[model samples]
Target: MVSNQNSKNLYQALWSSADILRSKMDANEYKNYLLGIVFYKYLSDRMLVFAVDLLEESASDLEEAQVIFTKAMDDGEVKDDLLYALKDEFSYLIEPSLTFTALVHDVYRGKFQLEDLAQGFRNIEQSNELFENLFEDVDLYSKKLGATPQKQNQTIANVMKELADLDLAHQGDILGDAYEYLISQFASESGKKAGEFYTPQPISELMTRIAIDGKEDQKGFSVYDPTMGSGSLLLNVRRFSNEKGFINYFGQELNTSTFNLARMNMILHGVDSANQHLRNGDTLDGDWPTEEPTNFDAVLMNPPYSAKWSGEKGFLDDPRFSMYGVLAPKSKADFAFLLHGYYHLKESGVMAIILPHGVLFRGNSEGKIREILLRNGAIDTVIGLPANIFFSTSIPTTVIILKKNRPNQDVLFIDASNGFTKGKNQNVLEPNHIEAIIDTYQKRVSIEKYAHLATFDEIKENDFNLNIPRYVDTFEEEEPIHLGELAQEIAATNDSLAQAEKELATLFGELVSTSPEIEKELAQFRQLLHGGGLE
Candidate 1:
């Protein structure tokens, strides 16, 4: 149970240490250095608790909390089972004597222990089977943290000491909250580069809703993201999801480094590796074990924009691409990613993917893919999101929801592009924007200008072009230029001009409505001519 006060303390402490490194490194680089340290701390704390539990359970000479509140321990068999469970639990094996705080306190006491700190991080990552290679090249003592070994180690040690002061309660409180706080802080500062990795919270919330709404009871089916970044998108689904069906989380990412971060994020968010199987490789090229693909209920993604791929000639034969009768263009692989997500979706599963607006209107092979998707009614909904919501990209993106089963042949088009606000450096959707989008999806409501339910005949007439303008009619005709009003206004202006000419002894120039100087002078002349010169 983390109180708001405790959360604040954790935020301030972690941010202070991270802030020290801001001037020393780029926003992206600082993330590795800082997240590496925080993760190191979490592992250290877990290990320390495990060590103490072992000491107490076995009556060994180590500090341990008295089992004050548990009557179930009265059974020796129960005690044995608990011990075995703790031993098997990688998340619970830490000892208090070896806590991160203990080590950092030593550093604050004049001990420059960089080697020890580095080894501690390595040991914890190695100790956990799934988290191996988790902090690759995140060497806190590297030249990236500082120039020389002495300076690097010294700064690294100081950073550890500062973080030790933070009150991040484990399992559910401080550490986990602080990790999210840091990820957001770093993401915002990193700009468009961050967008490539992190999906904004509002967007993720909406995606999760689109995936999990109405599926809360049935279990065994899973949800996946083919291009999992920080794992925030997957983990958050579990948090905000309102599911009537059970969904085990799954995903794959080409970036091994981000894959590791995704795994760590899932664990911190209370998802065991047993529940979420994250693969590290290009999902498009790799055949995710048949078991992984066949179990999903939903999939959500915000893949890299227009990523270049081996889109070789033979790729037309790949199962994910071959079915469409054409390959996605070599240069822009938006639909390629979409097809991959679509293939992984369960027969009745739903998947929502973020893509550039070009995917809607781009012709050639891309148009063919769109035709196949719509012809089969795989497209459930098309949502246009506000701009700057993504990190490395400020361009507005659209979310394409593909369902294996659509009861109706009508495609839902939502023009929510103008629904967000401009944040300090980026565009952001508030809760209202997220809710409106989610409600529209749930109710399938038709908003006059915001959403349209377009039939297949209409879409076919547009030649399979899913461009929003064709469906939503967002264009506003220039409020009919009033020629009659213009003539009458012109006559009034001419009369005023005559009066002004008599009063100011000068000819009046006709007002050019579009001109800046004429517009300003018109007011002055109108007043002077209509009611004589100014007092």
Candidate 2:
């Protein structure tokens, strides 16, 4: 078992590997290489452990096991059995020649070749259909790594040596969380592109908790994120559900590189390949997860804000949008994504999506869609979050929760904009704030100034507008003034001013040797004290 101290040490060691290449490339470019190598180390360690266990199973003692393993390395039958077993178990295999331990030792001995590790990645990618093209983003030969082959080899060697010092095989979440931590650090540094691949952790937590509130104990519980970025949001569902219960994870990412990151994140966090189904494609244009049924137990998303899509008339027949009878405008695809995910959601499941405030009040096609969802009682709750809470954009956002066939057509509106604690760079929703919102949502009651339950009649009376302030009144009134206290305070201030003027006059008389200009200034000051100064 790995101790807490050992885990912390491992995280620090793994993270420092980036410092070696910090000057050579930006986080966007260097992340692929750094994380790819760390994943390689994990795969290598896993294979070695499996091999050692296989050797120990048949031998009498540990020393005898090592001797048997050494002898088995030269036997074709043993090699074939080990390869088949490892491939079946891990969906990939690493040979002794290209294992991370072997490569690190080779670098120390001045006999390392970058091609060996590159070939290892290729072989793994080819070993199983699940791992195909997984390492396509890791380009060791890119100029970003180094200019020349020898220089690239040295740079990689330096990173390898730094990573080799860390114990990544610890039986804990240390390595996986460290990888996530590094991804977040890069996201913070990547600016606009951060939103393309990352959703801030706090937001992910809040959305996941709300989506999985009443369905934690259900067997074979599954969750889906249509716009899954880095697979963080989809993976967050596991924390709220039974850990031993097999939960199927599904997601689709538009960007190829981000899609690869999502896959790598899934594997690094110990999610079996059989449980993860991620696809790289345009989620809005394509029907995703072609192999599985559409309905999911919970659907969560934080898609690109107001993204553009082809709202052509051809989509009028698309089952996802056909019922609405109008497509989301070409300029903003927010509703398009919602409707797509909504089509795939189980009737009993809940969907909580993060979108900009415009979706709540935008006119034209969006308004029509809002009216349809409102009339159908699909919109469950609208939560207003604080601004500057997201790293990519500072616009105030809202989480729109939807449930199919909710008996009570009332929509719960929560005004949590002022609930965040201010940070140096961004506002943050603490755990208490998150729980408060969830508690109020679960109880389905109105809290003064923070939440309100807007009945269907009231919403229709307001013309189906779900703006938060319209339902929850957060306006604070000013305090009343006291004229008597004000008069007494003014009189006291006048007396103090008179006393100050007299003292200043005496002091100026004692300093008669000063310049005439100083004397004139003091006379003016006295006049001002007596309320006789020129304006």
Candidate 3:
């Protein structure tokens, strides 16, 4: 376990490395290098610590462990055996010369080369399937780092020196959270592009809690996120689940860079490679995980809102969207993404998806799908979240909770759009607000204006719009104004105004100006005040 003070120190150290890259590139581009270096250091540090523990020696720290390992590797008799043991323990082996500690030593000696670091990354990528091309996004030779090779090497060296003191081996449990913190900070700097790879933590927590409800203690619980940006949303299941290590994580992402990010996130979080089933492909273009146990217990998503898709006619026959009798519009594939995840849900599972509110009121294909989902009781709840909570878009969004084989056709509508703390750059759902929303969702009872449980008949009466306002009334009526009291107050105000003007006129009459121009101006002001023209 990592202590609070240790975690804070690690976060500051990791974030400070960004400053070295700030002048070289923007946060969006520099995040890859920073995160890649941090992850590499983690692997190297862990390797040293694991090797030291395996040696059963009293190594004081990683530096001593590195020296011992280097001397052991120098001995031809023990080198091969040590390499075999390391491979067995870590599923990959880092050379004594290429470890982060060795590289830091090189940096101090002014003997570091960019190729050495690149080779280290390549060595890990080629070692095992789990780490294959994991650092593909970290382009060492990119011109963004510097125009010349020496400058790039120096920049990377500077960043490494800044982060050389991070005790990743001891803080293994909290490293993943610190990595997430850096990613979020980068997202804040990336602006709209943040949506491509990150979901706000609070939103992720809410969706995870709702999806994992009633199944926290289930062994081997499985969760899937079709757009598993950074794999943060999928990892949230472990936080709310009783079976942390036993949960299976399944996810897919379209962006290769983001796909790699998800892989690193999972590894840093200590998710077992065997339990991670992530793919890099379009979730809508073709269905993945077409193998056994495809359906998951809890499916959560925060895909691109209203993104364009192929939406071909062939999708009508595809099982994921076929049941709906129509495909989601190409201009807005929100439902298409929704149906894909919903299709992979277990019969007893729960799913929660965040999308723009347009899905609830849009007509045509989306409206038809909404109508069918409502009639079948698949749509269980509609939660209207606050606007500007996301870094991607400022428009308010909704979380539509769905369940399979549900008995009731009633949908619980929660208007949580107004329940959030105002932030400098975005609205925030504090812990209490999230609890309130989850409480309403679990109770399934109607609050006066916050929530409403509408029956199938009520939805039918509204033409199956599924819009939240149709079920929950969030309109706050203004206090009534009395004409008699208003008139009395206005009259009293006018009387006071007249009395003040009279006093001002008396004071003006008593003024004795030395300058003729001032006296003339004072006389004109007095005339205007007495004539009631000032009003």
Candidate 4:
């Protein structure tokens, strides 16, 4: 564990590296360089520490560890043995010359070359399937870094120097948190593009809590996020689960760059390669994890809202959507994403998804699909979140909780739209607010104006529209108006106005103009104030 001040220092240190590249490119483009380098440094630092631990030797720091490793590598037998050990432990090898500490030393000596860093990245990617092409998005030769070779080298060197002093090796969770801090800062700067790769942390926490409410203690628990942007939402499960070490993470992303980000995020958080099941592909195009343990204990998603999809007729026969008898509209694949995740949910599992409110009330195919889910008692709860809670968009969104088998068709509606702290850039759900939601959800009881438990007949009464307002009556009747008191107040206001007008008329009467034309105008004004329109 890291102290709060140390965590703050680490976050600032990592974020400051971005300043070197901010002027040259937008956040979306520069984040690859910043994050890739940071991840490489983490791997290098860990490798040096692991080598020291394996040898049972005393090394004061990474610098000393690098020296020992370099001297050991001078002997052919020692070099081969060390390489095998590193490969077996980390599934990768970082040569003494290519380590982050060595690269920084070269930078200070004016001997650093872009190719060395590029080669280091290549070695890691080629080490194992888990790391294959992990650094593909970090393009060292891109003109975006600089126009000439020397300038690009200087640019990369500057960033490396900025990060060289940070203690990424021993700071366990702090290092991963700092990396997340950088990602969030970049997401804030990326604007609408942030939606493709990030979900607000509070929303992630809320969903994770709800999905893993009852089964927090279950061992070998699994969670899946089809649109696992940066894998932050998937990682939140570990935060709230008791079986953190045994939890399995399964996810897929359509964006290759974002997929790489998720992979790095997992490793930075110290997630084991064996426990991580991530794929870089379109989740909706085809089903993945098509093997044993296909379904998960929990499914959490915050997919792109209203994204266009093929919505081909062929999907109707697909097991995921076949039972619905209709496919989600092409213009809005919200339901398509929902059904896909729901299909992979275990019978006893709980799934939570964030989507636009339209899915609750929109008619036609979506309505029919929603009806089927509701009829089957799969739709468990609907939580309305405050607007402006996301960096990507200001529109308010809802979290719909689903379950597989239920005895009743009751749906809990929580109107938490107004329960967030207003922020300068976006609204935020404070801890208390999140707890209130989870408490209400677990209790399954209604609160006045805040929550409501509606029966199946009520939903059918409203034509099966699952809108929050229909279920939770947040409307507060205007405090009954006191007509008699209002009339008295109005009469008092009239009397005060009359008294002020009389005083004004008296003031005008005292104004006597010397010129005849001005006196005539004043007299007419006094006449109007006394009995004409003014009265």
Candidate with best lDDT: 4
Ranking by TM-score: 3, 4, 2, 1
lDDT of 2 by residue, 1-535 (tens): 1348867776666667888888888888788888889888888776666677875655433234334445667788788887677777787777667778778878999999999989999988898777788889888887876889999999999999887755455544767777777888888877777888888888989999898887778877778888998988988886778763388998999988889899889888888777888888898887776555778989999999999998889899988899999999999999999999898899999998999999998888999999999999999999999999987899999999999988878999999999999998789999999989899999988999999999999999998888889999999999998999999999999989878767866665455427889778877665664564212
What is the C-alpha lDDT profile of model 3 across 1-535, one tens digit per residue? 2469889888778877888888877888998999999999999998898777776765777789899888888989977887899898788888999999999999999999989989999999999998998988899988877889998888899899988887688886799888888888898899999999999999999999999888899999999999998998998898899889899999999999889988999989999888999999999999978998799999999999999999999989999988889999989999999999999999999999999999999999888999999988999999999999999999999999999999889999999999999999989999999999999999999999899999899999999997888888878899999999999999999999888877777777788889999999988887887687543
Which of candidates 2 and 3 reaches a greater TM-score?
3
Colliding residue pairs in candidate 4: none
TM-score quality measure for candidate 2: 0.89
- Please write out the lDDT profile of model 4 over residues 1-535, one tens digit for every residue: 3569779777777767888899999999999999999999999998998888877777888889898888887878777888889889999999889999999999999999999999999999998999899999999988989999999999999999998987588879988877777788899999999999999888999999888888889989999999999999999998888988999999999999999999999999989988999998888889887898899999999999999999999998899899999999999999999999999999989999999999999999999999999999999999999999999999989999999889999899999999999998999999999999999999999999999999999998989999999888888777989999999999999999888877877788899979999999998888887775444
RMSD of 1: 8.1
Query: Please, what is the whole-model Cα lDDT of each candidate in the order they appear?
Result: 0.74, 0.84, 0.90, 0.91
Listed in order, each prediction's TM-score against the native is: 0.83, 0.89, 0.94, 0.91
Alpha-carbon runs more than 4 Å astray in model 2:
1-3, 57-71, 243-245, 483-535
RMSD of each: 8.1, 4.1, 2.4, 3.9
Candidate 4 Cα outliers beyond 4 Å, as residue runs: 1-3, 480-535
Candidate 4 residue-wise lDDT at 26: 99
Which candidate's TM-score is highest? Answer: 3
